[model samples]
Target: MAPLIAVAHGSRDPRSARVVTAAVAAIRARRPDLDVRVCFLDLNAPSVDQVIDAVATEGHSTAVVVPLLLGSAFHARVDLPGVLAAARARHPQLAIVQSNVLGHDHRLVDAVRDRIVAIGVAADDTRTGVVLAAVGSSDLRANDRTRALAAVLAGDTRWAETTVCFVTSTEPNVGQAISLLRSRGVERIVIAPWFLAPGRLTDRLEAAALQAAPDVVFSETIGAHPLVADVALDRYDTAVVAAARTRLSA
Candidate 1:
């Protein structure tokens, strides 16, 4: 079987890396027979190229690179592909296939929903407003996709309204979102992160939310959630199957 390499956008925070490790461990635990490894794109060790080189050195003919990103931004679109393409050139014997990002699947809604409820906010509380937060991107479309998640999360319950805010971008921000919910006569506010792991970025967002509304509740990120691991493995399996089909056609 080909080794599955889970790639995450590395963060300076140690908690983020630990969560990535635990997430892949969940994947390995679910499919113990398969070889699962974790790597980072930047700001961390065992980078994507390092893992790719290791796979080639280990004599694996084929490998799958599953990006653990929630958005199809520059890192997912340009960064990882560039690394994989360069790796392919360096090792012609290795056939590398990149999997889809870990987003757009409905299962993630369940994962975020779990985070929301864990913060002591009732799912059906109409007076409670939700702020679905994410790391902003330069790609406008990617940010739009993140904004859509707010609606999906709102559908899960009757929470007053769910609005999306960014940690590092212009226009809509955490403070604005919190104020919007408050304007709607929502006294109870919950800020749910659309993040895979807790990092400095998440901390920044929480700080902004606190500044806007001191009583706001910020839930933990979707770190190492079993459903997140499930999504990564599903993407890996999907890519493997697609690669096999392409070979069959060839």
Candidate 2:
């Protein structure tokens, strides 16, 4: 059977790798026979090259490279493709399919919503406000994704307001966002992290929240949620189906 490789934007934080591994494990539960593996783009073991090389060495002709990113940013657009190109050159006969980043999936939205609910926000509390925080990317299109995600969550009646915030690379960092929410007369604010795991940026975001708006609460990082696993699987399936169609067309 073909192998499925889940690729993450690696970090120095071991928790990041652990979370990605857990998500891969959940996906494996749905496909017992097929080989499922987790690899990183950088800063961790089993880099994309290593994983693809192992797959090729094991005699797998086809492998799906699924990126565990929230949006199409530099890593998704440039870094991943570069890695895949190099890997393909090393093994010219290997068939590789690149998947899309996880962008605006309902499961991911639900996971964020769940985190908001977990932080003592009531379903009917109109006074409650939310700040969806993310690691800012230099890519404008990628940064827009945070706003898009906030809009989706704001539509729910439970959340009176949802604002997008970033830790870097964009305007209205978490601190500014929290102050803005408070200034709008919101009684309570919950800063929801749009990250896969707790990293240095997340730590800074939480610290800034405490300093800027001591009254506001911050939710836990959205790490290894089962819903995320589901979204990853959906992206993988979509990529595989698209690849199959392309082959037939050729």
TM-score winner: 1
Top lDDT: which candidate number?
Answer: 1
Q: lDDT of model 1 at residue 198?
A: 91
Error of 1 at 46 (Å): 1.1
The per-prediction CA RMSD against the true structure, in angstroms, equals 1.2, 1.5
How well is each residue in 81-183 modelled by candidate 2, as lDDT tens digits? 9989988999988999898887668678788888777877876789999999988878787777668888887656566678999998588898788878877
Any idea what lDDT model 1 has? Answer: 0.89
Evaluated at residue 167, the lDDT of candidate 2 is 90
lDDT digits (tens) for residues 160-243 of candidate 1? 888889999654999998878778898798888888999998989988888888899888888888998889989999999999
Off by over 4 Å in 2: none
